[model samples]
Target chain A: MKNLIKNFFAVEEVSAHCDGPCGVYDPADARIKAEAVLSMTKKILAMAAPDPSDAAAVVAYNNTMSRYIAIKEDQAHGTKTDILVLWTDFFKPQHLEATPDLHDKIWKATKLCSACKTTVSLESAEALMAAVEDIHNIFWAAKGRDVAYYTAS
Target chain B: MQKYPENAGFFEYVLLLLGRRKRIRVTGASMLPGLKDGDELFVDPYAYVATHPEEGDIVLAWHPREADLKIIKRVSMVLDNGCWLVGDNPAESTDSSQYGIFAFKRIVGKVTSRS
Candidate 1:
């Protein structure tokens, strides 16, 4: 009965796959944005605390700090999005076979980006950069290239 | 060699009554809830041959840049040239948002039913 039904139905198989085309993926995008996150983190950490009684200094300090924090959060988010796009779209199962820890690395990198957004931690920001550089090496290695990792800062 | 590819035998019977239907295996988490991974779907290749696909239709289309890659996404907007396709699960989907809109000609079939 199964053979008869299979022959009668004649179902040709198709696949409902997801992939982002254009063949233009680069880890540099994530690197640059993540670098901004690190830069902003450093600026925020290095900024001198204003005297509470000096109203003008307090106001100016607050404004500058807020701006730095905003930029850090925004850039961290952009970096996260870029990393995720590369993780899901650019890297495939074949790449996973080569780099078995790819998923763990991406997971930690994105987590660090989130940490950068939530806190003003220099360590987290630096870790994010290191993670992105690791991914950069993996990405270029997949393409059979030896691209050097550089920072805008 | 077989007359038809992908398990379609030489002695075909269903094609005459059903137009053209192919079994599509869902391969990603994009169409979750409605369609899960490994779900088999029947796609009608001739559904949009005569008329353009309307918005809200689930379609099996070729990846705009990669001719051989097939993607299943819902028609979000019907544009002048093509359609903006989005997956049901936004977090997991890399659709029109990432690669831009897909042209009408790239669409291969419309999903009819799940098996």
Candidate 2:
């Protein structure tokens, strides 16, 4: 009976899973996609004015916007993934202890990121960028670096 | 120095190495300028274990049929059903548009470092 109790209470070694923090986050991935979204918006607006007879331009504009929409969806997914990684792997218990607002900022950014997928608008894309910038701010703050300026359009 | 006759072997060493989340070097240009063709990269399997892959992050995934060939690409979009991935160099890459979004399980790890 004692042996059984000992077996039940055995201390097994817990394996470490994450490769300690290696700076890998890139905002360009999201920036380029957002720029594409903004450009598509401009194209759509330009094509809307002085209606072109070549229907091709309109079709092209529509296709470009569609692609941009797809890209936005992709960017949103990336943002969520990055946020999750930081929240789960990078932001240790020490981070929470250091910055109490970290959790709230991450949650807000994630929520805004999901919203980017549900709609197709420059404003929505901008909102997504804003959220990412917020995350970047928090990330830099956690790392004790001067918050890198991210100008999102 | 006293010799320990029954020490851990090579296979044990390899097992230990694989046991931890290790980074591997990406050797193809399929990912291009952003993650130069041949760059050392670290991966964190546990980081995105619970969450799904997102856009912009590079991921190492298995070839759906082959399983042996590991492909690396930037995530373009993630749907409830699958994830859309693309190579940085569109000119010479076969990606989500060609094969459709892939099942999430195929992803091995997220690239965490590059040098």
Candidate 3:
């Protein structure tokens, strides 16, 4: 029977699947998320301090600032996740031969992510963006692809 | 079109000695874009009996991590100690990168043709 024949030859071929951890990775993922964090920080800083005399104005300002902080927090974490995935999955041990400081760079970049989420400073957010750009350049270079630098306007 | 062994062992050797290749059904995606899961191929065990596997050849070898496990991977590089076996789809494969080099004796056969 066809079923019997199929079962007879069904040899389990063990595949690495790259362990299902590696695939095409793009640094643009971290860039966009870091951008969100920066944009949120800027918006929060630009919001006028609510009128102290008006309870509603104070509440409105508080609500808006909290929302911006929440977005920044989420996106900052997302940036960290994107960077870590590319670092762990895409980059191989051989990549370190090309970019000798890649490990230190990733370490500092991830730490920047935490700083952005913990603080409302635009400076830290911009620093996170810079770190992500560094990673992006390294990633593209490893792939022999040319990509333009990401900037915040 | 003859009945093959349920467990590929002595019967495969018997068939090879008879000048016929053994058929094996691929069950993984490590060789993606070339070989797929469920694709059938004729393995020429005698192909390397008098020789050695060259780079870029797809080979069936015992998993270095486990003795009973068998894996299908490409010979990326032949090192002084052993061969560096890697899967075409590294993202899902656990090859030389994870388990180190594969010993020459572990290689079972060479995948000659696919159907």
Give the top-scoring candidate (TM-score). 3
Off by over 4 Å in 3: A1-22, A151-153, B1-91, B94-115
Better of 1 and 3 by lDDT: 1
Worst 10 residues of 2 chain B by lDDT: B1-10
Candidate 1 per-residue lDDT, tens place, A20-121, comes to: 443478999999999999999999999999999999999999999999999999999999999999988678667888899999999999999999999999
Write the residue-wise lDDT of candidate 3 on B1-115 in tens digits. 2112133445454544465565667775566656777776667767677777888888888876566777788888987767898877665577888889888888888876652
Candidate 3 per-residue C-alpha lDDT over A6-29 given as tens digits, one digit per residue, 9 for 90 to 100 = 345534454434433456578888
lDDT tens readout by residue for model 2, A74-106: 766676776777676456556777778888877
Q: Worst lDDT window (10 residues) for model 1 chain B?
A: B1-10
Model 2 earns a TM-score of 0.41
lDDT agreement with native, every candidate: 0.80, 0.59, 0.77
- How high is the lDDT of residue B44 in model 1? 77
In candidate 3, position A6 carries an lDDT of: 35
Question: Between candidates 1 and 3, which one is better according to DockQ?
Answer: 3
Error of 3 at A59 (Å): 1.6
Which regions in candidate 1 have their CA more than 4 angstroms from the true location? Answer: A1-21, B1-115
